[model samples]
Target: MGIFQPLNTPIRDWQGQRVWIVGASSGIGAALARALAARGAWVALSARRREALEEVASACKGETRVEPMDATRPEDFERVRERLLAAWGRLDLVVFNAGTYQPLRAAELTPAVVRGILDTNLLGVMDGVAACVPLFTRQGRGAMALVGSVAGYGGLPKATVYGPGKAALINFAETLYLDLAPVGVSVFLVSPGFVATPLTAQNDFAMPALMSPDAAAEAMLAGFARGDFEIHFPRRFTLVLKLLRFLPRRFYFALIHRLTGL
Candidate 1:
């Protein structure tokens, strides 16, 4: 491991690689699946909608498996994992990208609202990682990519529940990397800036540097190829957010309020 070397093994080749994407039915997950399949990876698509998963699978150019399951269910993860292992013998990469979001303000705070976001964005992600950690550790050769957001970097308006969940996920990915890297299991944290997807369509405010889902998928693949631990983009937007993380609390808060006008 040199100063300039990549943190994880560069995944430049995808031919015959077995990959399971938990949120592969749409958005970045669907785009990634299609891209990887085009590269000849055997992709397994999983989400609550069987029909949606099938639709994405149909669009994929290479080998694909449709495994519909709920992200919030631990049993679903376990079940899917066993099925994948049985079919592929081993999983070279597993991506936990399933998430849900809702714009929330302080005035709209409620337990159900908070729990709904946390269940999919935080708790479900943790549960999925837990299911894979042991298998990856035992195999001593695997990769896990966790899809997070720039919102995790700092607070902003209308992200009361979403922000905290992603913040926790970012921390979780970092901690997972610390424990798993030495064992040959790579953990990648994907922090994307605003990307145009069904998830972001709900936002009423103007989205800066909003990229298409396909572009986001391309960025992620490029990151994996570079073996970057934290893959964030587009740089024009994410760099500013990264800088904000270093500012003093008072200044950071003030700056965010001014920029977002929230």
Candidate 2:
């Protein structure tokens, strides 16, 4: 491959592609489902709410399968994987986008709160990817996209629990890419900045570079077409955060405190 070549095969043709999105009930996942369906991809939508999943499936233009289940449960992932494999024969792409967040500070931390966020955001994604790894490796061709957050790029004041989970997820995606890329399986980490979604609706602080779910989906599609390994959007915002990672700890902490006022 050339030095400037895409890291993975560019997915420009969506016709008849079989895709499974874990958090497709609403937000970015739902938007992506609709976008892909319009391009003729067969989508399978999964989430905890059957009704919501059905609602999204109904809005899709092409074939769609609704697989409602909790992201926290590994059994749920296994069952859904089996169902999709049985029905579609093979999956061309699977996006582990299920995640939950709560604005938390160090003093406000509780076991329940910590577990709730980690179960869905970190452990859920790990297990879901585990379920699909074997199949993707066996098939020797497939794409796995993990929807993480730019917040994972570094520490922040209010994101006590949420930040850690996303940080772990980013690390997980890196390791997965290293292991899977040579095997012909593509691993993509989607680091989205403040996207308007039910999850972000809980934020008490002002979000920078806020984008609609549709806009976020469009950015993701563009990234996929370019075959970028890390598909981060609203570059004006994410690039600043990426740059912050290189600052000295004292400078970074002081800057973050000044910026967030938390």
Pairs of colliding residues, candidate 2: none
Model 2 residue runs over 4 Å out of place are none
Q: Could you give candidate 1's per-residue lDDT for residues 1-262 as a string of tens digits?
A: 8999999988989999999999988899999999999999999999999999999999998789999999999999999999999988999999999999899999999999899999999999999999999999999999999999999998889999999899999899999989999999999999999988999999999999999999999999999999999999999999999998899999999998998889
lDDT string for model 2 (20-129, tens) is 99999999999999999999999999999999999999999978999999999999999999999999899999999998888888999999999989999999999999
Model 1 segments more than 4 A misplaced:
none
- RMSD values for the candidates in order, in angstroms, are 0.7, 0.8
Which residue pairs clash in candidate 1? none
Instruction: Report the Cα lDDT for candidate 2.
Output: 0.94
Each prediction's TM-score versus the true structure: 0.99, 0.98
